[model samples]
Target: MSDQTGSAGVVLKYTVSPDDFTRAGEASSKVKNILKQMGISPDVIRKVSIAMYEGEINMVIHAHGGEITVTITPQEVLMELKDVGPGIEDVEKAMKAGYSTAPEQVRALGFGAGMGLPNMQGCTDEMKVETELGVGTTITMSVHMEDK
Candidate 1:
């Protein structure tokens, strides 16, 4: 399903599966395609895609699964990821580079570099994270559109 604004912008949603390395980047890839079809700038698309991809992977490795909603408008692209996995205990520690809690099997696959949250923050113009110890985590990120 999608929501339309005055300018015909689009909102897309995807469900992430647990430990699904083979399909990890699918959601981000789809978002990139949608942005391209809408004639969004490549730079903006790149930033959103990278951030979304990282979040998706984190959901797979840590959260077991999650849901992501992406909203594209004339002004910015917003991505919201909600997961039912163990919530982050320390947001500050999690944000540090080279710090990861991923299992060995996951790290062997060339992921779990401890860069997911940081990378997401770096790529987005705005970001907010809400997490509960045993409940879940929700991350909202936005990338503003730039004039061509």
Candidate 2:
């Protein structure tokens, strides 16, 4: 971890492993724990945790593997996920609930329900997805924090 100099927040980075369902939530858990230690409100922590977790799952199931950068500031929490894999074919179609490209086996593992992106969107104040077929995908999500 780098020094938190000149920055109003903490930036945490994690490398995600593809197809690692058992460890999917590890990054999110760590972020949530850090937020708790920092005394962030439960609502804000939940929003950040859930959104990042979905992004993590997306990376594992769709992008093989990826990197997540989470920045926590007094004003907002920002999460950026970048991956090198087959990008999303249709962002609109993928955003719909119950739509999934995950294989049957992945579905049996309790993921690929097609709600990852939507849940991410719902949890954050703003969400942006940049992807190119056969290239890669990057998702940025942010949630604002209220004055305590």
- Tell me how far candidate 1 lies from the true structure as C-alpha RMSD in angstroms: 1.8
lDDT of 1 by residue, 1-148 (tens): 3445555467788888887889988988988988998899899999999999999999988898899999887899999999988999999999999888888998899888888899999999999999998999999999999972
- What TM-score would every model get versus the actual structure? 0.93, 0.93
**Tens digit of lDDT per residue, candidate 2, span 112-135?**
888988889999999999999999
Error of 1 at 135 (Å): 0.5
The global Cα lDDT (0 to 1) of model 1 is 0.89
Cα RMSDs of all predictions?
1.8, 1.6
Cand. 1 TM to true fold = 0.93
User: After best superposition, candidate 1 residue 144: deviation in angstroms?
Assistant: 0.3
Q: Which clashing pairs does model 2 show?
A: none
